[model samples]
Target: MGELDSTLGAVLIAGLLAAVLHGLTILQTFLYTQTSGSDGPLMRCLVLFLWSVDTLHTALISHTLYFYLVTNFGHIGVLAAPTWSIIVAIYLTSLTGIIVRIFLAYRLFLLCGRYRPRLRVALPAIVMIPTMITFLTGLIFASKAFIVRLFARLDTFSVYLYITFSAAALADTLIAVSLCVLLYRSRTGIEQTDSLLTTLIVMTINTGLLTSIFALLCLITYSIWPLKFIYVGMYFSLNKLYVNSLLGSLNARKILQAKQERSTHDHRRSVRSTRFEVVSEPASYLSPAESITMSGVAQKESFASTSNTLHQNHVPDQT
Candidate 1:
């Protein structure tokens, strides 16, 4: 096989790897549903929807690779040829990205709270608009690929692709930053609560960084090495990362919940032990002054009760 063929094969290999990850995420989602059993209908539907989109994305990309490698068989020219499957794959990728972004944006909105000013709500939404626009523009330009057989004629297409990736990266960065900030601010002085929040912050950053870096890499590789299919592999894996990130975030809640519960249980136990110690302490262990003070208080209480009883008897005799 030629160098170009080998490069294309690498793209396929990347797609396969992405598919494997996607399968694992599917299992994770399934296990999450079975184990958690508390996710509402909306959450369940969202998981199913994201999984379906991911499945479609994998199928489309696999078809595109299969068509190029198996059917065309060494026809390097087919790489430049825009097939229907390739167009659909591009569309699906964009769709998957937008859906995930929307989900994240909603999360940010909820985290910020409804009482937050309108500007805060609008900020993330505004940033995401460009991302959606660029993705749509990229999809539109991809359709133009069919007519513009000359790869050189598709120079403008690269601009749309780059913008799309940049916008996506920017949005991801905003999401991560916002989530981290909100989570940090929400931290109570309590150790257990803060620790849980810290875990969430770390996960948010890691997941956001993973997708943003992939998007940036795709943008860089596509712009610099337009002739090669190296960037295509990253592009194929991009949606998988997004899906996995979302599912992983969702599944992580169970773990966080368990930890939080354990922390609470330990805290309660400590409190109970403290109270028991305070209650069970013997008076003999008190200081001499404290014991004298206790005896005087008890004597006063007894005298007051006897006086009250005598006053009641005298009142009946006078009546």
Candidate 2:
């Protein structure tokens, strides 16, 4: 009973939590569709793809739990082997994570590309290397688990699981740090623009750290209590976090835009008759939402020859 409690009980609870998070993921996706009509087709397709994958992920894990706790309820021996659904679900989790990471890496690349061509190319590659490692190791982890087919023998190749989580953590940390550093560096002396950058930096840290913390927790719990399913439980929630973070970032563009508008209005009022002009520059960091814009400027207090600037006009409120 103690063994069953630790293994099956933990998975059951984790699956419940995952179901709850999946509900939130669905809500966020619906909200995204309603609010992001102006977003490019590629962005729309990406959102749909992630939601579909996550839905399937939820279904598979649910089936796995059902198979153990209900279908084979009286057969204690069944707990020794993993269901095929659970292994495939783990692979899907990896797939969802890599897709989100690649999207974020591209955003980071856009942010850095204007400042230095080499940096733009190099930073995304650095992030992706670990990301790809995580994905491949995850594939290998699933394959080995399917081959071994027994819970008791997982330790024999636990190294693969460790590598998968470790590489994921590294990739997420690199992306967060790189983005925060670039946003910090983008600060113009203008209070509105600087505040906007600060907000973006904070968002990057929170989202990035959220996933990274769970990956580490999964790794830590598994290391300390290898026989328990606590790590698997954590793994269940981790995929949902990846999807929600992406959606949250996308949705935040509206809030940031509203804040930028109010700040711009106040700044304009303070100067009374002063006019702000948008100068032309290459390397636009305009996102699908177009919340903030950067351009070349000759201002004395600007961060660089190219300055962080927000316009009075932007995408209409999607609400």
Candidate 3:
């Protein structure tokens, strides 16, 4: 009943996206308990928040997209009870997700010396304060204009939608810029240990960039093609990437630690062997005394030094 067609293929795709988001939500929720540490709590909370909201947002967007364009269900129309409310929820959720994402971006940005100042200024407001303000503001207005109360007054609420959505888009753009700077700075010196961190940082930046673009597109039109339905699905995959990359990094670090421990033990053994001395005294205590020197150990040590060149190249490069 909306100004859109009902194609079954679109509905099917929407369903698939919804399913993906839901699954990601469940996985993240289950893994959250295993995550622990000082910053881990915060990151896990952010992830959980994003995934949970994404599940709802994606489901709503998919259904909205389906009803309007994908499926000619008997109950399809603007007059559908949840239409405008779902739009408000999606708009709010998208913005919240962006805030959480920017928090992640800044967390990485702090590791890049150049962007720490920018993060210190921007991240706190975006993640902690402004999100609550924006969500509360939208809820206040949207509650007053619930679909049932204003199904006939839909046109009037369009202005509010534009206002809230534009605010969210602007916030996201600011975040994208901060992350772009961070990623640009991180490219050269990122160590293998930090590879996962680098990936999340890049993914956060790219996701923010794409989300901002999509939000802008939504502002420019009300068409089905530019619908905000796919944001949740995108969030799901990116979070999975973030979690997996970090998890692998942690595993690799543990393995490396174990290898270092074994190498240390062997090095100590070799050092002891290289300096080893076997002391001996001939038969009677007072009659005759003889000392057997560790020339064998000394000779072996000299041979090792000449053959290996380990000591010669052990010093670090100052530059």
The clash count for each model shown is: 0, 0, 0
lDDT of 1: 0.72
C-alpha TM-scores of all predictions:
0.82, 0.84, 0.51
**Best candidate according to lDDT:** 2
Ranking by lDDT: 2, 1, 3
Cα RMSD (angstroms) for every candidate in the order listed: 14.3, 9.2, 11.8
What lDDT tens digits, residue by residue, belong to model 2 across residues 171-230? 989988998888887776677777877888888899898899999999999999887888
lDDT of 3 by residue, 117-227 (tens): 766555645543434544554565567566445334544555654554465466556655655554455443313323433554555565555555655555554333333
Question: Candidate 3: TM-score?
Answer: 0.51
Scored by CA lDDT, what does every candidate get?
Answer: 0.72, 0.81, 0.46
Runs with alpha carbons beyond 4 Å of true place in candidate 2: 273-308, 311-319
Q: Candidate 3 at residue 109, lDDT?
A: 41
How accurate locally is residue 217 in candidate 3, as Cα lDDT from 0 to 100?
54
Ten contiguous residues with the weakest lDDT in model 3 = 310-319
